[model samples]
Target: MREWLGWLDHIESVEDSLNNIKARIKAFADNGGYPESFAIIYNGEIAGTVGFNDVNKFNRIGVVGYWLGEKFQGNGIMTKAFESLIEYGFRELGLNRIEVSAAIDNKKSRALPEKLGFTQEGERRQAEWLYDRFVDHAFYGLLAEEWHSDNRED
Candidate 1:
């Protein structure tokens, strides 16, 4: 896990994640915007994380981001977690739109938003500096109206 996540060296350590959690919670409480992040727990273990980021209360929009441990892939865990977060972003947070971006070469990550019915908005060149080089990102977006219409229970 450490080796694979080396690209996220900016995080430095677990303590960084904890501090980020507290900051995000505080930002939400005070401004009604900011990511509502959570650990992805499965079977009493931490599998990964999923959350909404870059929340804009005035514009009613946010970006979604998530990751799952390699061991937990192919189990539909992230999809379920993302779906719940999407619902929360729209229904609970009153957000109008949610976007997701993944490294263009990361097929697995890129497939998630598509599987969840988010439209591929476009690609951004050199959107992320992974480790040594920049990586492009494929963007996807979904609107509250679109989500509700597609997910309406019969």
Candidate 2:
């Protein structure tokens, strides 16, 4: 609750998501989907969160999402978090692919995928209706085989 509240105070969309967390978790469980979520802790304090929502079992895919505390930004922490999530998605979850979408203007979010070598599939024009306007989004994806090969030494 404290983590949600802290994020809520500063992030408008996060504030809205806070209201749906409980019900969303319940729904995810009911649908046989694991709402893989975790909080980043440093010095025993919460620094950020990362998670997947609306996971589809048939397709073996999930949408990635995350946020970091302002103090933790631009330090490669979020990249580590994303790498952890992707590792879990491919290995533990037995997923074939992971997808992410970010507003075109969200440079940090968009850069994270490219940094991890995710292919930018395409842009969805006006796909996200956030902050009371339709904003374009860039979609990126990383395949399980790609991740697996990247880790192989031989």
Candidate 3:
């Protein structure tokens, strides 16, 4: 985990919310009162992780967060990985809605939710801080009903 965290810091474009890198991994493993974390691996290396940030059981809604290291940018790896994760969210987790957000300047990230047909709900100006700077984040969502209808076959 230190390797990944150090890579994030070195990139200068990536920011993580933990003082201790292993602590973050432990918390994710423990779930802190949430569900499991999913990893999409490629060639036996850590590709990335995508999982629920907020999963409301009563409402059956989940917010997913994903991050890919700088070295693996592009090549459509994240898209292929995310499709499987999203499918698991809707099918296995039985979630009604899956939400994703990206910094407005992150053109690479904005494409993920868009390609998946998520509805853009506008930007949150100065909503979050990253690398000592504030950034606008664009919110998006996809409902299970829409997923089923859009991807189903006759």
Candidate 4:
């Protein structure tokens, strides 16, 4: 968890974890669901999370974020989750553009957007501070028209 998600390293206890979860929920509500989140359930257990963060209704844009437990990888769980999320962002939230960014070296995270038909935009140098070091981000974006055209059943 600490490898990619450095925040987990700060959670020293179960209480801390609970508090973090609470804070996230509060932020979601406070922002009018701009950072809407969803838990990925696998075999009746929470396997991960997928969400749209940094949502801007005025600009009709949102950034996608997600993480899956090590035990849950390679099961196609995130792929399905993101598919639904992208649909929700466009169809329900009326978003015109959605973006995704992942550590340049984190292939699994970066692959989600690519496999979902998101176009690779560019890389942000030292975009995130992960624990003791910075990591570059590979940015990708998908537009509403692109999604609709690709998904339309002709």
Ranking by TM-score: 4, 1, 2, 3
lDDT of 2 by residue, 1-154 (tens): 2222223444468657776677777865775675577788866888988878657779999788788888888878888888989988887787899999887888877899999989999999988555446778899999998988887432
Deviation in angstroms for 68 in model 3?
A: 1.6
Best-performing candidate as measured by TM-score: 4
Evaluate model 1: give its lDDT.
0.83
Q: Each model's TM-score, in the order given?
A: 0.87, 0.80, 0.75, 0.89
> Cα deviation in Å at residue 59, candidate 4?
0.5
Query: In model 1, how large is the Cα lDDT of residue 15?
Result: 95
Best model per lDDT: 4
lDDT winner between candidates 1 and 4: 4
List runs of model 3 lying over 4 Å from the truth.
1-35, 152-154
User: What would you estimate as the lDDT of candidate 2?
Assistant: 0.79
Q: Flag regions of model 1 displaced more than 4 Å.
A: 1-7, 31-35
Per-residue accuracy of model 3 over 22-133 as CA lDDT, tens digit each: 5557655665443445666777988877777677767888888777766777778888778777787788778899998887877777889999889998889987766567
lDDT-sorted candidate list, best first: 4, 1, 2, 3
TM-score of candidate 2 against the unseen true structure: 0.80
lDDT of each: 0.83, 0.79, 0.74, 0.89
